[model samples]
Target: MKFTSEEDTYSWAVEFGKSLQPGDKVAMFGNLGAGKTVISRGVCKGLGFEGSVCSPTYTILHEYPNNPPIFHFDLYRLEGGADLYEVGLDPDYLSQGISLIEWPERLEGNDPGLTHIIRIEILNETEREITLEKI
Candidate 1:
C-alpha cells in the first residue's frame, strides 16, 4: 500500500496489527527513516499499549507493559544469528509474547517462525510503500 505520510503508514499498521495473535512474530524491513518504528508504534497501540514505543536500536529490545506484552527488537547492531542468540533471541524468549523485529536481514538463517513480513519502501521524503506478506 502507498502511504503519503507517516501517520498513514501508522494507521495502516494499527489496523493490520489488530488481527495479530499472541504468538505472532513480525519481520519488518526498511531503511533508515522508512517508518518501521512508526508502524511498530502503531502495532503497539493496536495491541492496547498506550505508552511511548521507541526504536530498540541501541537498547536491542523493548518490552511493552501490555497484557501478553510486545517484544520489540532491533537487530541493526547485531552481526548475525549468533549475536541475536546472545541477546536472548531464542525461541524460548520469543515465545513469551508477540515479537516485532527490525532489520531482520541480520537474522538471515534464524527464522523465528514469522507470521507476517512487512517491507516499507521509501519512495520519497514523505512517501512510503508498505508491503505485507503473510507467512
Candidate 2:
C-alpha cells in the first residue's frame, strides 16, 4: 500500500494493530524518519492504548502499560542477536506480550514468533510504500 501522509499510515496501522494478539511479534523495516514510530503509535491505539509511542532508539526498548503490554524495540544501535539477548529481547521476554521491533535485520537466526513483518519504502518526501508479509 501507498501512503501520502503520516495520518494515513497511522490510521492503517491502527487497524493492523487490532488484529494483533498477545505474543505477536512484528518486525518493522525502514530508514531514519520513515514513519515507523507513527505506525507503532497507531498499532498501540488500535490495541486500546493511548499515550506516548516514541521509538526506543536510545533506551532500546519501551514497554507500554496495557493488558498484554507492548514491547517496542529499536535495534538501530545494536550489532547482532547476541546484543539482543543481552538487552532481554530473547524469546522468554518477547513471549509476554506484543513485540514491535525496528531495524530487525540485526537479528540473527529466526527468532521464533516473529510472524509479522512490515517494510516501509520511501517514495519521496511525503510518499511511502508499505509492504507486509507473514511467515
Candidate 3:
C-alpha cells in the first residue's frame, strides 16, 4: 500500500492492527523517519491503548497495557544478538503477546511462527510504500 501522508500510513496500520491476535509477531523493516512509529501508534490505538506510543530505541522494548498487551521493540541501537537475549526478547515475548519489532533484520534466525513482516520504503518525502507479507 502507498501512503501519501502520515495519517494515511497510520490509518492503514490501525486497520492491520484490528486483525492481530495474541502471540502474533510483526516485523517492520524501514529506514529512519519512514513512519514506522506512526504505524505503531495506530496499532496501539486499534489495540485499545490510550497512551502515547514512542519508539523504544533506547529502552529496547516497551510494553503497553492493552487487551492482549503490545510488546513494541526497536533494535536500531542494539549492537548484536546478545543485546536481544539480554532484553529477554528472544523466545519469551514471541509467545506472550503481540510483538511489533522495528529493525527486525537483527533477529535473523529467530523466526516466530505466524509472523507478519511489513517492509516500508520511502518513495519520496510524502510517499511511503508499505508491503505486508506473512510467513
lDDT by residue for model 2 (1-135), tens:
999999999999999999998889999999999988999999999998988899898998999998789999888888866455676677887787899888888777646568799999999999999999987
Q: lDDT tens digits, residues 1-135, model 1?
A: 899988888898888878988888999999988998999999998888899999998998999987778999988898865455776677776777889999998887876789999998999999998889999
Q: How high is each candidate's TM-score? A: 0.94, 0.93, 0.91
**Best candidate, lDDT:** 2
Model 2, C-alpha of 91: deviation from truth (Å): 1.5
Between candidates 2 and 3, the one scoring higher on lDDT is 2
Ranking of all candidate structures by their lDDT, best first: 2, 1, 3
Clashes (backbone N, CA, C under 3 Å), per candidate, total 0, 0, 0
How do the residues 7-125 of candidate 3 rate in per-residue lDDT, one tens digit apiece? 99998888899889888888888999998899899988888889999999999899998889899988888665544566557666557688888887776665545389899999999
User: After superposing candidate 1, which stretches have Cα over 4 Å from the reference?
Assistant: none
Q: What is the C-alpha RMSD of each candidate to the true structure, in Å?
A: 1.2, 1.4, 1.6
**How does candidate 2 fare on TM-score?**
0.93
- Estimate the overall C-alpha local distance difference test score of candidate 1: 0.87
Off by over 4 Å in 2: 110-112
Q: Clashes in model 1: which pairs?
A: none
